[model samples]
Target: MPFLKTAKLSAIAVAVVLSGCSFKEDRNDIVVPIIDAQPAQSSKLQFPQETQQKTKTVPTYSYTVRSGDTLGIIAQKYLGSSQRYTEILALNELKSSDAIYVGQKLQLPTKGLKQPDELQSSNSNKKSSDIEPNKTYPELNELVDSQQYNQAIQWILNQPELSNNVELQEQLVELALTQSKIYKRQQQVADAETLLSGLISEAPLTQNNQKALISELSTLKAEQELITAKRFADQSKFDESYDILLVAWQQVGQPLENNILFTTTRNKVSEHYHQKALRHYRSQELESALVYWKKILAVNPNDDLALVYQDRVKALQNKLENL
Candidate 1:
């Protein structure tokens, strides 16, 4: 009986050891290694209001508006349908599709196309700088299609070999003009003037086509100046407005008298000067009135009204001097 009890105690000790080992193994099983969690790619680009559904993830692209960019054109190029312009309007909270302005940021739903980052990754298989001009053409074309005119121009200019390439140079001219137009539309007058002037200086001004483009750019620049001057004049900043108008009027390339934008702004500026002259005249400030009248005549030399006003003011000035 004593031998059996000792044996039983030994068995109990073995069982307890086994049970402890099992408990330790279970504790070990419960412990998980901590990993440094990586954020999902979509989260990086997502807006606060954007929610992903159970369907496959759709990529989005952000585009900046250039001149002549309409919602229909943007939607058709990026979303595969002009009818999807409503989607853009809705996404942007725009009252109308036409309300988009140059330089405005647009969130585009790239229905079948990859996002810009994904496109860059795929294009990374080949270094853009090492690619031949002919090979780089498609990428530049894609930039134009995306309304990324400035980027396209920079890419072309970065390629030293492309300087002598006539086709690429012509493309550069067009892209530069487009970018300048966008700048003008956005009221970035200095940027527009700088880009257009650079392009004009680079092109052979004697070449018919190059000359035509230069003239067009100059005319556009003048028109933008006129618009800007009129805006300033409307706010009663006559001196500032007159300075811009003087530059625009003396641009010397194209006669802007026939251009509608030019005509409108010119008329508005003239009216502002004429009104100022009348104000001085009413206050019996004949000399100040003559000065304003002469300012109007400086812009429009053939203005019958300004000529008559100047004559009348000068006569009043002479009479006041005599008195």
Candidate 2:
């Protein structure tokens, strides 16, 4: 019994040492790491609150076109440059700058920021005193006084400096008058009238004796209209010629025979209107033909050709109605 007990005690000591060695091997060879649920440092991906942006709303407004309000003038008032008139055209969906009429409503584009070059151009335009007109006007005046009309016109057009100078503007109108008179003498009536009319159109409100000048220009213009109308009638451009005479006659209060030139042109256009009516009649366009015949009778009830054509068209219209 004592030897059996000794053997049991020795086996128990050996088992305990084996278990200790197994624990030591686990400690030396295998490892488990501790993990954290939260980060140690703040994230670099986070943006500052101030860096966030909100959407912006664009602004818009409406405008009305008053009399004498050109696109350039409007642009100058609002956008700061006459050159920016094209921007207004795009905003309004207008095909041409000339399409706007008095009392027309235009959509104003007020949001666009001015480009650097455009701002510079606006500044340059506002500072036209940079060009000393005193140095330039004497030579231009000499060209006018000497009757070098073409040269004077070319010089005036080329110099943007002369635009706002009241003294130079008056001289320009006088030069234009001289040019028109010279053109009339040369029988270049179209050129004469155009120059005079353009001058009157652009003349500023502050000028002296502007009404008298306009009256003189109007008389000359009426005479040129008659001359051009006669030329058109001779070329068989009857409708175009008559249209010119019609405008002149209306301007002069639509008198029957106030001036010999007007009377002559009226009679000539009356015959032409009758001819145009006959042409329309030959093409079986009796209704259309009656329009020109009526115009002829309106100008002169005594027109024999117009009376005949008018009667013929009315009879044809009656026949068609009966059928």
Candidate 3:
């Protein structure tokens, strides 16, 4: 019986050793209890209000009113429809469509609106120095189609890659021409001329493009002079009007000089000045009369009426001085 007890004790020791090996084989199972004991104390400590406060605010977008930015154009650019300009009017509490001015900051709708960087990234495979012309052209055309000429010009100028883009250079020239015509139509002659001149100086225009821009500039100047002369003549400032017309005639050449509007305006101004000269001559204001006659001759150097009147004025002056 003692021998049997000794054998049973030996069996118990073997079982304990085997159990330790099993535990060693399943060592990974011990980690669960340790993990459970240390429950996420930090998560429990987090306040709901603090968590809410940490949540990000919905972002908004805005645009600044640049030169030549109309509500329709702005809406087309930012909101994707020119017709949505009314939304801008409502948002800004603007009573008139004409109320927005350059440098005004306007908040844009967030929906469907992307930041400029996001637009640049998603629209084109752009590198630091190069851009995908195909993708970029459509974006530029949108601004052009909206008649946002100045903004389009600014956009093109800001793109450094456009400098080497021959197609874009040509497009810029065409866009400038179109914008100049619009400015001329609006009677903003100076603006039209300045826009052309600036593009001529800044753009890498082809020879033909340069010629076209220069020609347009000349025509614009002539048209402006004619308008100013007509306005002065209407105001009865005949001498000033005649002087302006004379300058325009001398400056412009060929078809422009022979333009019907210019010719008609010049004749009207000259005749008005002639009538004033006649009045001065009859009133014995010889110096004033001579001044008008001489100006008329300066414009036409071969005017029979002006030459005859000028001679008569000089002869009369001599006679008066002798007397």
Each prediction's whole-model lDDT (CA): 0.58, 0.55, 0.60
Which window of ten consecutive residues has the lowest lDDT sum in model 3? 27-36
Candidate 3 residue pairs in clash (backbone atoms < 3 Å): none
Query: Over 4 Å off in model 2, which ranges?
Result: 1-220, 253-256, 298-304
Per-residue lDDT over 1-323 for candidate 1, one digit per residue giving the tens place of the 0 to 100 score = 99987775455445434433221222123211111112223444233343222222445567876654556556555676544666765666543312344555677776664344325555458532332234557888777777777788778777776645777776677677667657867988788777777766764333654665677676776776776777887787878887776677677322765666655666677777766776765554557878876786566554434554454555444543444
TM-score of 3: 0.37
lDDT of 3 at 263: 59
Residue range 181-286, candidate 2, lDDT tens digits: 6776788878876766665666452345355457556667777678788788778787888787767655553343456776677766775565566566545556
Query: How does residue 320 of candidate 2 score in lDDT?
Result: 41
* Candidate closest to the true structure, highest lDDT: 3
Ranking the candidates on lDDT from highest down gives 3, 1, 2
TM-score of each: 0.36, 0.30, 0.37
**Residue range with the least summed lDDT across 10 consecutive positions in model 1:** 30-39
Query: Once superposed on the true structure, which residue ranges of model 3 sit more than 4 Å away at CA?
Result: 1-136, 159-166, 231-240, 254-261, 269-323
Off by over 4 Å in 1: 1-199, 202-214, 252-254, 315-323
Clashing pairs in 2: none
